[model samples]
Target: MDGFSFFIYAFLSIFVIVSPLSGVVTFISLTSNMTLHEKNEIAKKAVILACIIAVFFAVLGNKLLGVFGINVDSLRIAGGILLFTIAFDMMHAKISAESITEEEINRSQEREDIWIFPIALPLLTGPGTISAVIVLMGTAPGFQEKIMILAAIVLTFAISLLMFLFSRRIHRFIGYNGMLVFTRLMGLFLAALAVDLVATGIKNIFPMLGKLV
Candidate 1:
C-alpha cells in the first residue's frame, strides 16, 4: 500500500483499540467511587498494561498460535463469535461486568490490583482485538508497515489513557445518558467488524466459492 493507505490503516487501528466510548463506560464503572488521584494512577497502569499486551501479540501472536496447534482462521472464527456476543451486549447497553461469573467477580474483587484483569484484558485487548491484530499483521506489506501499526497502537492507547484519566469531566459533559448512546454506537461498529471477520475467514477457507459465486 501507499502512504495514504498506510495512514488510514494506522488511524483505524488506533481508533478501534483505543475505543474512546468504551473507555468512558469502563472508567465510570471501575472508578465510580475512587478519587481523582486514584483514577489517574489506575489509568496510567492500565495504559501501560494495554501497550505491553498489544506489543506482545503483535510480535508473537503467530508463534503462540503454533504452540497451541491453532491457525489464523480458527482464531478469526472464535474471535468473531466472542466479538459478536460482546457486540450484542453493547447494542443493548448491558453491563458487561455484571455478565461475569459470580465466582470470577468475587475473585477479582478480592484482588488488590485490577489494572491488568478485565479492564485491560477482555475489555480492551480481548480475543477479538488479538485476532484482528494477527490478521492485520499477516496482511502488512513489510516490517515498516508493522512498525507503523505498532506506533498506531501505542498512540491510540496513550490517548485512551488520557481519556480515562479525565473520565469524570467527560462523563459530566456528555452525561450518563450520552455515554450509554455512545457505547451502543461503538458496539454496533464492533458487530459490523465482527461480521467482516467471519466473512473474510469463510472466504479464505473456501477459495472455490470465490469463482462459483
Candidate 2:
C-alpha cells in the first residue's frame, strides 16, 4: 500500500480501536475529582503506553501469531466479536470501573491510580486495537508501507490522547446529550465495521461459505 492507503487504513483502525467518543465520558467520570495536572499526566501516560503497545504489536504481532498457529482470518473473526461487544456497550454508554461511583468518590479524597492499567491496557490498546495491528502487518506491502502505517497509528493515538486530556472542555462543548448521541453513532459505525471484518474473515477462510449461504 502507498502512503495514502496506509493513512486511510490507519485512520479507520485508530478510530475503531481507540473509540475516543466512548472514552470521553470515561475520562471525565474517572477524573472528576482530579486536578488538571493529574488528569494531564494520566492522559499522557495512557497515550504513551497505548502507542508503545501498538508499535510492539505491529512489529512482533505476526511472529507471535505464527508461533500460536493462528491466522489473519481467525484473528479478524475474533476481533470482530470483541469489537461488537464494545460497540454494544458504547451504544448504551456503559462506563467501566473507570467511572467513579458516589461511594468510591466519598471514600477517597485523592485521585486513584487508573492511568496505566485499565485505561491504557485493555481499554485503549485492547483486543480490537491489537487485532488491527496484526491485520495491518499481515497486509503490508513493504517497508515503506509499514512505516506509513506506523505514522498513521501514531497520529491516531495522538488525537485520542488529546481528546482524553481535553475531555472536560469537550464535554462542555458537546454536552451530555450530544456526547451520548456521538457515542451511539460511533457504536453503530463500529458494529458495521465488525460485520465487515467477520464477512471478510469468513470469505477468506471458507471461500464457499459465501456461496453456500
| lDDT values, one for every candidate | 0.71, 0.78
Cα TM-score per model: 0.86, 0.86
Can you write out model 1's per-residue Cα lDDT over 1-213, one digit (the tens) per residue?
A: 796688577657546534666667665666666778887887888778877887789788878888998878777767677777777877887645423333554466545586777667766666656776776666577888888778777777878887888888888899888987887887787788778777777777787875575
What lDDT is reached at residue 144 by model 2?
81
lDDT of 2 by residue, 96-185 (tens): 332234454344435465776566776678777888788877767888888877887888889898898789999999899998888788
Cα lDDT over the full model 1:
0.71
Per-candidate clash tally: 0, 0
Q: Report the number of the highest-lDDT candidate.
A: 2
Clashing pairs in 2: none
TM-score of 2: 0.86
